[model samples]
Each structure stands twice: as C-alpha cells, then as structure tokens.
Target: MLQKNVLDYLDSSAARFPHKLAFADEARSFTFGQLRACARGLGTALADLGPQHNRPVAVLVNHTAANLAAFFGVLEAGHFYVPLDLQMPLPRLRGILETLSPAALVYPAGEETLAQALADLCPVLCAEEGFAHPPQDALLDARRGRVLDIDPVYAIFTSGSTGTPKGIVIAHRSVIDFTEWMADACQFTHQDVMGNQAPFYFDLSVKDIYLTLKCGATTHIIPKKDFLFPTLLMDFLEEKKVTALVWATSAFHLVANSGVLEKKVPSHLRTVILGGEALQAKQLNRWRAALPAVQYTNLYGPTEVTVDCTWYPIQREFADGERIPIGRACANKEVFLLDEHLQPVPPGQPGELCVRGIGLAKGYFGQWDKTRSAFIQDPRNPNYPDLIYRTGDLAVMDEAGLFTFLTRQDGQIKHMGYRIELGEIETVLNSIPSMEEVACLFDPERDRIHCIYTGSQESKDIAKLARASLPRYMVPNLYHKVAVMPHNPNGKIDRPKLKEEWIHGNDHRL
Candidate 1:
C-alpha cells in the first residue's frame, strides 16, 4: 500500500510557483524549479536500487542545501532516512550504523573522502553526484510512481540510557497533517517567509521544510555560527523580512537576554514558535515586552509523534513567576489524561497523557517490540479502529478541557525514599529572579543532586533563592555556573553532557 510521499507536496508547490525561492542561506538561494529538479534527480537515481536492497537509508550530513535535497529524495525513493548528527563522534556514529545496517550510506560530496579514512563502508552515494546518473528523462517525467500508504518520511535517532540510540519513524501521513495544520494555525500564505534554525537532523527542520513545500511559502536556512550573535541574527531576520520562525526554548531565552538584540527587533516577524521544553512565564513577559504583537507558541511532543503533538498559544498577559501549561492538542490530534488503570481521569487529577490521531508515526525503525508496546488500541474512540501512543508524560485537564503537562513519569525521583518530581525542583529554580535556565540532575554516587544553571546570578543569590521555597534536602548540593546548558540540535537540555562534565567523579557539596 504505497502512500503519497512528502516530496509530492514540494512537487505541487513547484508547479504553482516554479520561480519562487524555496531555500536560501548566506551562500546560495534555490528557486522552486531548481529545488524540485534536484529532488527528482536524486529520487530517480535512488529508484534504481534493487528490491533486495530495500531498507532504511542512513544519512550523515551537515546542515546544508544538499541535506535538504536528500531529505526529500530519500522519501521519494520509497525508503526512510536515518539522520545522524554531523558533529557526533565517529565511534558513536559507528555504533548507531552497526545496529541498523542501513541499505545506503548517504553523505555530502567530500565527506566520503574523510569517511574512507576512518572505516570501510558500503553503498555510499555522494550527495552532489546523487543526480549524476539520472533515470530516463521521459519515464522520470511521466511516472508519478507508487507511493506506499505507510511509507515513512524519515527516521530520527534519539539517545537511550542503555543499548544503541533508537530511531523514531514518522510516516507520510503524519508529516502531511503537520504541514496542513501549520498552514491553518499559523495562517501562512505564499507571502510568508520561514527561517530554518534547527539542523536538518532535528525535528525543528520539519516545520522549515513542510511549511515551505506544502504551503507554497519561501524559506531561508540559517547557519549555526549566527546563533552566537543573537542580535545579528535578528538583524538578518529583519533584512530578510522573515514573517515567522520556530526555536528551542533555550534559544528564545538566550536571544531575549543576548544584550545585543535588546529591542533591536525585527519589524515584519509575526509568529515566534518554541518547543522542546516548558516556557517560563517571566520569559514570556520579556518576549512580549520586546515584540508585543508577536504570537508565542509552546509546541510539545516527543519525536515519536512527528515534530509535535500539542501546542499552547500565549495570547494574554500572565503572572511573572508562573510556568505556562502545555495546553490543548493541535488539530487532527487528541490528547487524553489516563489514570493508573489506563482509564480516563477526571479533570484536575494527574494522569498519564496519551495521544491518538493523524500525527502518530508508523513506529520505531527496527525495534518492533518496543513500538508495539507504545502503540496501543484506543479504548475511548469509536469512529472505526484507532490506536494511541502512550506519551509517558504526567498531565491533567482543567474545567475548560485544557490539558497541562506535569512531568515525565520517568522524571520522578525517589529521594530519601520520598518521590519527588523534577518539575517541582525546576519550578523552584525558575522562581529565583536571576536564574535563567535550570536543570536539576541527581548524583547517586555522591548521594546528592547537582543544580546546573546559566543566567544572571551570583552564587550567594542562587543559594538564597534555593532556600526560599525548598527544604534543605531539596536544595542542590553543588551549584555550577556556565555560559549555557548543553543543548542538542533540537534545543533541549543535553543531560548526558551535564552528567559527564559536572556530575562524574564529583564529591563536592555546597
């Protein structure tokens, strides 16, 4: 059962606006015609793959126009792509690939030269030359090809505490739903220009790719170094007249306080979307002060459900010291709170939040058992057969049917034999006036918890802030200040680095 591929959206967009710019960075800009032709060529080249070789293809490429082409090309070829971070250590990457034994190894033109220097690999396609051996032009032009009903769009690799990293497999339907929802929710027209912030590997790029391809909008790709100069980044947005953008919560905070970008605001920017973490009310206030008319959205979801499952639009004024809730589900998705028995929980009682609908992914790439466990039959829905993914997140709904995220069930800590939610500790940390970003990690070896931070505060001020609402044991034993918290490409906290750098072999106390 072949389904419509993600690139079909781009193909349709190209037909309507062949000359409109589809992708751009400081180095180059691609019109819809050029981008579509490149994707078609890559697809045609990859279509020559034999039946015995049909398996997931893994791609390790940097954030570039080439990666963007591969993103669509892999889907059009009827194979899922495993996106690996370009900056990851070679050993870590080797471990990931050894697990999947992917069919094709896709990389940039010059990367295979470096790859050969490290390990002998197979079936490698130079991205620049991917379209070199194009298919018969007439057949390629005439054949729309059969797109499988359940063919995956892409496979995103995520870390696990044990074993190799896992791949979250998203299907074409989920990608299409997200794009259509975005087109409506954001009110994007062909006039809108979107900026690509997150790397092609991370889910944030989904918003960048689909919005442009499906909605007939223009897109601009941002480089990594520009982020260091938050003010200059804003200037770029202004000069380009970007209408909308999405960013990680950590990034939004950095830009708001970046000092260089203080009210050096862009005039045409409208929607400022954020995700991968909870939004602090005080941070929202700062953003509102700077761009009052801009719509700020808190997008929430794991990689299993495409880019996001739910979103909260911050519309009005809020209290300074509060944390905004995760809010309701987006269109085409339904979120419900379930109790210990997996039955629906009444409003206001905390329960595990579950998701069901069009945004759900096909499954994890190779771990069928794990995928089966997460995807379950929906007990509540009666409109034909339905399956829901247990989100493993604790949440509750208010009288208004608006759901709010509490914390991950895994985030619970049995401290001194008392179960404590990390969200509670993080909220206390946010209450501190000077604290910007806070992450509390438990150190069992030292029998203490370490609170890591980056923001405006002295040690004494932070200590004073900690003692105000927390019991003595709840306070972090060690306080370390750094320039910023380690964040993955998705803009979420990198707790692995936190453990490695600050927690390992440390026996110090405050």
Candidate 2:
C-alpha cells in the first residue's frame, strides 16, 4: 500500500517494537509505545489550542528523545514542524521567527523565559505540559484523515545568498520515498543500532530518524560534547553497541585524524555513511586501515532533495591523493548534468548537477520567486511541465558512469583573467603530508585568493609546494595558518565564517 503519511511508519514500528527503545540520549530514553502516546497527547493539545491545519509550528528544544516526539506530534496535529537551533544568536533567530510567523512556538521545559519573549509573535506551548494533556482520538483521527501524500511534513532553514534564511519545505512523499530507498540500499534491519551525529534542525538527521522508524531500529543521539574529545566519543560509541553511523564528512575526519582509532576502535560499527561535504581520501584511508571490514558509503545531495540523491559504496581502494567518486543516482531519482544552456553535457565534461524525482522538495516557504528560480521546467520537456531542481554544484561523469564532484559553481573564480576552481588548489594543498585541513576563498573586491589551513608546515613551505603543483594564477596569493580550523553546527568547515575572519579581517594579507 502507498503510504501517504510519515506517521504510518512510526505506527507500524510501534506495534512491532512496543517495548523496544526507539530513541535515546544521555539523560532520557523512549520506547516505541511511550513515544506514540506522548505524540498523540501533545497532538491533541495542539489541535485544541489552535484549531488550524496545515500551518507551521516552530519547535525550540535541545537535541534529545523529546525532540523526536515533538516532531511527530506536530505531524499528528495536521501541521508541519520547523526546528530552531538553540545555539543560534537572538538576532538571526528573530529573523527566522519574523519570516515564519508560526501558528505556535513549542519550547522545552525550563525555557519559559525564552518562550515568553516571543509570545507576542504567536502562541507558545510548553512541551511537557502539552504531553500531559489527554488524548483526543476522534479529533486526531479526523486531522490525520485530511493529510495527503503531497502535504508538507517539515521545513528546514538554510543560509540564503541574500543573508536571509530560506526555509525549504519537504513533503511527506519525498521523505517516504527517500527513506524506503535508503533502507533497502543500505540493508537496514531491526537489529541495526544507529549513532546519529547531525542536529535535529539539520536535514541529515532526517535519515537517522525516519530510517529507524521504517526499519524498526534504534538510534542513539550522541552528545555534542562527546565530539570535542575523540577518545570519549569512541567510548560512547563502544558502550552503546552502535552498529551503523550516519555522519557528516567533517565529523568522520575529526575521529580519523585524531589518531585515537590507532589506540582503540569501535568493534561493532558495520556501516559508515558520510555526506554534507566531499570526503577526502586521506582521512578515509585512516579509517580503512583500522576498520577494514566495515562498509563505507558516500552520499551527496542538497537539502532540497530529501537527504541525498546519490550513493557511492566503496568497492576499491583509493590513494591519498585520489578523489572518491560520488557515484550514481539512488532508486527513483533522476540525476543528470546540464550545461549553460540547460542542454545535456557530454561525458567527461563538468556541468551543473540536476535532479528530478519524488525526492525534490516542494520549494522555499513563502518565497515563490526564489523557488521558481531554482525549481524550473525541464527544457527538454517542451510539451509538458516536467520540473527539475538545478543544484549549483559542479561534477563530471566518466565513461563508466561514475560521477565525481568537482566544486560549487560559485567556487569558480576569475583570477588574473583566468577562471580557476578554488577546490583544485585546495586539493593540491591537502595532499601535502604536513597539511591537515585546508580551504581556499577568493576576495572579489581585491581579486586575491586566500588559503586558510591548520597543519605543522610553515606558510612559505606550503606555498612553495602549491606553486609547483598549480598554475601561477591559481596559487593562493595569501596564506593563514591556524592551530584549529573553525566548523559550523552541521560539522562542515564554516566557510562563511572563515571568509569573514580571514578575508575581511584587519590582517588579511600575508
């Protein structure tokens, strides 16, 4: 049967694993049955508070088992959810609130002061209080009956080019399709225990949340503090008996480069899937050397396409200097490349990555112009309205049908009257044995390229090697060495923050 609602996955799993732990954190845990009951009670409270359907409900809470229940409760109330980062600055959070104007704001217990500050914007509800409300089965059943496959399930905010957050609304069908395909492709089963690294607000967490419900598996929300200490993080993984890991590439690099794996390894981890950034071969080689029997897969996509549209299972060994192919499209997704004119690019040529399938998002919330600009009609389909999402990322395909990510479209900069890909320069710098992490940013106003890296080598020595490897114009004109590289909440290198600090700071030039 076709599943029109994501709650169906949870309902079936709860029936099968009523007594089993579905989600856990350091302080609390929730069984499948308990989670369902909490969600139903909260849904009833929300439905009675605001007799509206198909509106946004912003959730501000810590990353815990309760967060998952709140998300399901919003869906149960016939409304989509919007997760707000607790660590976000007040100004930015206010901007998002201004844009969302949600039907209600749901806050965790002990955050009444924070909730009251925004009461003027909309109604506010305490999570614990809502969960204690009596369940209204008839009202919830009627609300659920009105939901369709195309209804929006959740909305995630991503950084926009204009500095305002662009909320990406994903529908039930998109997530349902992606989760079903991922479960089968990755062979997820009830016995698999997953360790999730992404935050609730990030789209990467979607895979961990829904995949567990679809497969009747358990997921452990690893504490954020554990990531700062590599050995402690390994201990947490070992103690939890985690069998699968769905993590960002930067997090994988953190553990591999720490040399802790050489001291101790998580014996039970069988599957490691990485995404949100390109996975370098150097750090991956370290992981392979230790856990040789574990399965490693590379996933690539933007939030606009569920979690990921492509998957590459490692079948061969890679040299430290070689690039890992992003590989082919996943089931039910149509992934291709287009040139400047929207025409198909020939094999071996780099072009913009485009995707069209059941996984494409509904579009940006309340921003129709931006949505129309990105999700547009396929030029090839002149007779019909076939839509495709144009991802600004660039890639190349080999004759054997393997796709290799090159860089972002904006990463291509005109320096010294020559078009240069900053990623190519960073690749050369990363191959240096003394270099640990590296990124290249261009200053359009000054027409200069700056290299920010963390490693043991001196700036001049690294520059000498870069000069020998890249063209004269592509070599970075400025270099900044640091003891530690800055990263964002999603675990990717905070490129924007780096640009603000390194390029726009007082001492920008070498």
Instruction: Give the top-scoring candidate (lDDT).
Output: 2
- Candidate 2 versus truth, CA RMSD in Å, comes to 1.3
Q: Which stretches of candidate 1 lie over 4 Å from their true place?
A: 1-3, 51-54, 117-120, 135-144, 161-163, 379-385, 416-418, 444-447, 470-474, 501-504
Candidate that scores best on TM-score: 2
Off by over 4 Å in 2: 507-510
Per-residue accuracy of model 2 over 1-510 as CA lDDT, tens digit each: 878999999999999999999999998898889889999988988999767798899999589889999998999899999999867887787788889989888888888988888888888998888888899999999999899989999999988545578999999999999999999999999999999899999899999999999889999999988888889989999999999999999899888878898999899999999999988888898999999999999999999999899999998999776788999999999889999999999899999999999899999999999999999998779998889999999999999888999899999899999988888777778878777899999998889999999889999998899888888999999899988999877778889888888778775243
**Which tens-of-lDDT digit does each residue in 7-34 have in candidate 1?**
6778788899999988887776778878
lDDT (Cα, 0-100) at 278 in candidate 2: 89
Question: Lowest summed lDDT over 10 consecutive residues: which window, candidate 2?
Answer: 501-510
- The true-versus-predicted C-alpha distance at residue 271 of model 2, in Å, is 0.5
lDDT of 1: 0.76
Give the C-alpha miss distance for residue 145 in model 2, angstroms: 0.6
Q: Write down the lDDT of every candidate, Cα atoms only.
A: 0.76, 0.90
